[model samples]
Target: MHEWVRRGVGTVAVVLAIVSSAFATPQSLPQTILPGVGSTSWEIRNDGGTDGGPFAGVCDGSPAFGFDDATSASGAGDAYDGAWSVWINGNPFVAPGGLVDVTGTTLLAGPVAMSGLNVWLQYFFSTTHQAARILVILQNPSPVAANVTVQVPINFGSDSNTTVGHTSSGDTTVTTADRWVVTSDGGRATRSIPQSFMDQVLPRWSQQVIRRRCSTVLLETVSVRHSTFRCRARAPARSCFLPASAISPVRAIRLQEQ
Candidate 1:
C-alpha cells in the first residue's frame, strides 16, 4: 500500500491506504483511515513491535506521494506485506532481539538500531522538500568487514501508469545521482544519494570485500506535476577497512515537486 502527505498554506495533511492487492477489484478496494494526531499528522506502524522496522503512514489526510510495492511489478506477492524491515549482514532487523531502538516521524520512520554490529538506521524528513531520508551508519568494531543490504519496495505500478528514470550529476566536492517515479495522475517521487563515499571505498578494499557488499547509498523518487517524494539511504565511508571505526557518510532520499 501507499501513504500520502500534503502541505498547504499552513497545514500538513497525511493519508494512508492499505491495498492488500493492488490488483484487487474496485469492489474490494484497499482500506483507508484517518488517524488522529497533533499538528504533525504522520504515524508509524510498528506492527506490534515484531518487525522492528516501522512502516510509515498517514494519520490524518491523503497520500501526497506514491511508491510502488516491491512485489507489485514482479507478481511475487506483497514484498513488504504491510511491515517494514531491514537486513544487516543478511540478517533481519527486528525487535526483542534484533533492532535495539527505533523512532517515528510525521510522514516516515526513523532511527532503527541493531545490536552487536553497532549499526544504526536513521531517517530524516524535509517538510520544505517533501522528502524522506535514510542514514545507515556502520561502526564496525570487529576485524572482519561488515556487509549491509537494504531492500525497500519500489513498485511504481505498471509502466502505463508510472514513468521511471534516473540521473547522475555533481562535481568534485560531491557526486550525486537520482532515481525517480512519476504517476500518470500527477504524483511524483525521487530518491538521491552521493557517490563520494562509494568512490572513496572502492579502491582500498580487496575485490572479495567489494564484491560481497551492496551499494553504499540508494535513493528512489516519484513525482507529479508540482509535488515530489524521495527516499534516500546512505552508508559509512566506502573505505571500510582503513578506519578502525567508520561512520559512513550521509545518504538522502527526498520527495518534492517538479
Candidate 2:
C-alpha cells in the first residue's frame, strides 16, 4: 500500500508539471480594448487581472501612457503595467471585497467603474491632437466626506530618447511635457542642427529638439471631497524625420471650491 501511494503521488506531480508547461508555453496578446480610430489607438491586458493596464506602444502616433506605483520621481515604474487607482477616505479605492468594472471604446468612451468607492473613470481621445482626455468623478454618497488621491502614470518612449519633465502652467494648473532630441545617426544628441538648412549653410548636421505638452485640470474643489477632475493629455506632432515618442506625466492638481 505504501509503494502504491508513492507511485500515485509521483504521477500526479508529473501531470501537474505538464499542465503548467502547456499553459505557460503560449503567450496571449493584449486585448485591444480601444482600437485605433483615425490616428489614435489603445490596448489593455485583461488577463493580467489587477495588474492589467494600457499597453506601451504608439497611441495616435504618440507614446502611450499608463500607471506607475513608485512614489519617487526618479523611480518611474513601468509605463505599461497597469492603470492608476485612487486612495479614497484614507484607504485604497478598491476595498478587499470591492469590484472594478472596466468597459469603453476608442470611438466613443471607455469607462471604469469602482463599486466600492463609487467612482467613475472615463477616457477618450482628442479630436484635434493625438492625446487622451481622462475624466475622474467621485460621488461621495457616504455620510462623511471622503478624501481621494488619483494617481496617473506617464510613459514615453522613442527610438531616439525618452524623457519627461513638469512645469507650472498657471496658479492651479500644471503641465507635463516629454522632450525628444533626435540626430541624423538615430541617436540622441545634445544639440541638433537643422539638416535641411545646415546642409545648405555649412554642410554640417544639426540636432532637433521636440517638446509635447499634456495638461491636467481639476474641475472641482479637492478639499470638499465630492467633486470632479479633468485631465487632458495631448501629444502634438513634431517636426522630425522619425516619429517622436512623447507622453505626458501625471500631475496632482488641487481644485478650488466653485
Candidate 3:
C-alpha cells in the first residue's frame, strides 16, 4: 500500500454520461456517473472533449477512483485513476480533448504523440467494475523507439472524505489488499495483468508521492506492482490488458460492490 499520509476528499455528484457516435471535431465534456441503476453505476464522459474520459470511476456502488465535480480545475471532473497521463521518454502525451468515442462496451481515445511515439487508449468497461480492461495501443508513426511510462495518480477512495481537521480533499485510506485497493469504507479497486497478454508487466504504484497533486515521479515502484512497456520503431499497436477479474470477459474491474 502507499505509505504516505495526507488527508483530503470532497463531495462528488453522480450524473449519467453521454454516449455518442464518432465526431469530426472536438466537443464539450460532461463529467458524471451513470454507475448503472441500483447496484450498478459508472463514470464515463461524452462531453464533446475529454470524451470517453475517466478510465476509472464508480463501478457498481463503490468508487475506486475519480471524482465527478465540474467545479474542479478540469471543469468536468477529476480522474485520479492510474494512466491519467502517459509519459514517453519523460515527455507527456497531450492533445485537446474531444477525441473519445465508445462503441458498445469498448472505448477509444487519443492518438496523441510525444517524442515520436503515438499513443491511443482503448478501454473496455463493464457495469459492475471500476476499470475493466485497458488496451494502450502504441505505435511510432515517426519511427522511434520510446520509453513509455503510464503516469497514474492513485486514490484508495475518491469519496473518502472527513471533517476531523482542516483537511478535506483526497482523503486517506485505512486498509490493504493483496490484489485490490480498498478503503476503510469497504470500497475496492485494483490493477493486474492478464495471463493471455504475454511480455506485459504489472502496474506500479507510488510509495512516496502525494495523493492528488502528483507533479513528477516514475509510476513504477521498487516492488513488482507497476506497469510500463516499450515500443520499437514501427511496431504494431500493442495490446496491454489491465484486467480486473480473472478473465471473466474482462468484466467486473475497477470498483465492484460488496
Candidate 4:
C-alpha cells in the first residue's frame, strides 16, 4: 500500500499522497456510529510550501482522502457502503453525495500527475422535511485553506426518465456540478454542503478540489440527526401522567362519562 506523506513548503504543506494499492478497499477509513464518518490517512511533516502559500507533491506514495455525507446510512460505520474515490490533481476526494462522473480528459483543477491508478473515496447524502446537510471531512496539514467542491447528480431517476437532469440557469449552465470548500485554521476543518445546491442538481454528484492537493491526516466523520416533535393531550391515566402542580390536587383524576 502507498503511504501518503506531508512535505512542507514556505508555510503551506503539500500533501504527498502515495498511490493506493489495488487491495486497498473502502473499509480503510475510520469507523464511527455517526451517520457519516471518515478519515484522511497520510503521514505529516513540514517541508513543501510556506505556511501561507500553495504546495505540490510527487504523487507516487499514497492516496489523499476526503469524506461524504450519508443518505440512507447513518453514523461513521455506514460510510463504506456506497463510497467512491475521485481524483483531482492526483489527490483522492471521497464522494459525500454518491456516484460521480469525470469522463473528461482533464480535471477542472488541472493536469494532475496521477500514476493511472484507482483509489477508494467514500460519501453519502440525504434530505427530509427539515434542512438538508452535507458533511465533509478532509485531511490537510497546511496553514492555508484548500478550496473544495462536490458535484451531486440531480436525476429524477425513474420519476422522469424522459427528462435529462441538466438544466440551464441564465448564462450559467447547470450540470451535475455542485461545489464546496474545506479549510484548516491550524486545526481541523469541517464543511457543510448547502441544501440549496442539493435541491438543484441531478441524482448523481462528485467532490472536487479547485486549486490544491491534500494529504491524509486522520479520518474525519460527520453525521446529521434531525427530529421534530408534537405536543399531545394527556390520556386517561392508570396513574397520573402529568406532573404535580400547585393549582391541581394530589390525587389522580378519574374520567367519568357525562
- lDDT of the candidates, in the order given: 0.24, 0.24, 0.28, 0.22
Say which candidate scores most in TM-score: 3
Alpha-carbon deviation at 153 in model 3, angstroms: 1.4
- Stretches of model 4 off by over 4 angstroms after superposition: 1-132, 143-258
TM-score, prediction 4: 0.22
Write down the TM-score of every candidate: 0.35, 0.33, 0.41, 0.22
TM-score of 3: 0.41
- Output the better candidate (1/3) by TM-score: 3
Question: Ranking under lDDT, best-scoring first?
Answer: 3, 1, 2, 4
Q: Which numbered prediction scores highest in lDDT against the true structure?
A: 3
Give candidates' CA RMSD values in order. 17.0, 22.1, 16.8, 22.6
lDDT of 3 by residue, 1-258 (tens): 111112111111111121122444443333333433222223443221122222232223221122222111112222222223333433434433544555655555666654444455444544433324544434433322233344432322223331111111222332221112212222121221111111123334222221221111111111111133221111111112222332233211121111
TM-score of predicted structure 1: 0.35
- Candidate 1 per-residue lDDT over residues 1-258, each given as its tens digit: 342111001101111121111212121112111122111111223332222222242222221111212211112222222322344433443323221222233222222344334433333333332223333333334445544433332222232233223222322221112111122212332322211112222212111121111212222221111111233221110000111012223323221211
Using TM-score, rank the candidates from best to worst.
3, 1, 2, 4
Native-vs-model 3 lDDT? 0.28
lDDT of 4: 0.22
Query: Tens-digit lDDT track for model 4 on 1-258?
Result: 111112110111223222222222222233321212122111111111112111223223233332222222221112111122233343344322222322211011111323321222322221221112222223333444354433211111111112112222322233323221111111211221111122212223233322223432111122221221121111100000011121121222222211
